[model samples]
Target: MAAQGVFITFEGIDGSGKSTQARRLADHLRAIGRDVVLTREPGGSPGAEEIRRLVLEGDPDRWSAETEILLFTAARRDHLEKTIAPALAAGKAVICDRFADSTRLYQGITRGDLRGVVDQLHALMIGREPDLTFIIDMDPALGLARAKGRNGAEERFEDFGEALQQKMRAGFLDLAREFADRCVVVDGNRGIDAVAADVARLADGRLG
Candidate 1:
């Protein structure tokens, strides 16, 4: 059956304020009486949460690009079957902080071709596209600076240097173009309120 509820995803490079804006958008929807559920990929369901640790906490040398992609797919499958699908089935709008696009950007950077990875994810889990995806675009250098300023600690991926981050940023823009129909590229260089306003507008259109 076609889903009755809306599924929206937030995407961006690190420190693009996607999480914060996603929460704001969810809150706005709830205020208007829409059934909303806020969630995140790589760490939404119980099984996915466990996979999140394995993906993020391990030593950089411990995992190859393919291994990282596989782990992400596993987490996504768990999240879809256990959390996302169920919530949407119940007629609740699901706003996810990060989704399949992350893998396309990160894994794509690690392993040149991302089409195969995306195909694998689609095969493993039912191909479910977000009703709307807000891609908060920002300069890699500025975004990383914000990330570093907010948190002293760094994960395996976050520890990557500027060049790598630039590549990931490019990947995000590329994916946004590839999925233009489903994606909205939000300018994230402005203040949080400005960014949140764009997110609110997008959610309002979808939820209405």
Candidate 2:
């Protein structure tokens, strides 16, 4: 029988360095002789990647909270069907930069009070959750500044500005509390190496 694979996700307000940490952890796991498949939500599969551009590249007000919830769910369903599930079935550790938890916040809370809608759609279309999640915590202003510095096309969320990030930070913390068993919060205020080290250690405990 194939060894069981693990589903891991990194989440935070934009520019919390969760993506960097996710990459580091994937490298660490690979270096330790484990099979790892590093991916990201909203764009893991080709179909989802198309959706990613639609949702992430447009104006901040381009889509309402309800519409975005639908778009994200569609993307996530495609991602799971095309990428995440196949890798996990093959017994490869799947490391994702972001996942459903992002929708739970960005649309569920920050954009509007539609957690119920997001939850209902998630339960219907995407029924999976990460086995382990790292919530990189950081100051909203700092994170927004870092995100803006990237000057990337996927700046719709960043354009929402620091206030949205602040709400997102708090919402993520609340989510951590709600799902304490799988969610681990890491301070993102220090050096990348320091944060990566902590993530690797925690992941080791679970991946063992």
Candidate 3:
């Protein structure tokens, strides 16, 4: 709300097409001559990127929920200071691939009790939230199938398997409902073009 430009973030379980939609939305806005800065977490900023590698490219049990939350918050803080804040201050829309909502959901899944800690840390360290958060909603099974087809070294979280994915999907939907003010649930089961159109239109509406 303090930003001169809009802040938008894409959130969803893996393979829900959130990343693709984020890219398309950024492109759409830029084509219309909007100054847009497209970025992603946990490595949007240089320091954060280093933290991203440490957190992402390791065993599933690499870090405890508490530690993971700290790393994510640190990355987010750096991202905000180095990239997001500067872009918005310069009056450019900041479109992030994944943001705090992902942190809430993922950490929630890893350890239910830590949700409180995550929220507290977020408030203390990273106080800002996106102006609009697009939750690309989709079925867990299908998302898993789509995710499994992709190969990446950052497969630790993906290895949580279908059960955690389902829980994460539900958690995202619940967040959308809980934070209906800024969160919009976009149907991710549809074609990419259709989904992108909806996301772009919604974002454009906010740009007003």
In model 2, the clashing pairs are none
Query: What Cα-based lDDT does every candidate model obtain?
Result: 0.81, 0.93, 0.89
The alpha-carbon RMSD values of the candidates against the true structure, listed in the order shown, are 2.0, 1.2, 1.4
After the best TM-score superposition of candidate 1, give how far the Cα of residue 92 lies from its true spot, in angstroms: 0.3
Over 51-150, each residue of candidate 1 has an lDDT whose tens digit, in order, gives 8888877566667777788888888888999998889899888999998888877775545676586666656664778888999988889888887677
Q: How do these models rank on lDDT, best leading? A: 2, 3, 1
Best by lDDT: 2
Give Cα distance to truth, residue 134, candidate 2, Å: 0.3
Report the error of model 3 at residue 101, Å: 0.7
Question: Residue 68: error of model 2 in Å?
Answer: 0.4
State the lDDT of candidate 2 residue by residue for 71-174, as single tens digits: 99999999999999999898999999999999999999988899999999999998988999999999999999999999999999999888999999999999
Q: Flag regions of model 1 displaced more than 4 Å.
A: 1-3, 152-154
The lowest-lDDT stretch of 10 consecutive residues in candidate 3 is 108-117
Per TM-score, the best of the predicted structures is 2
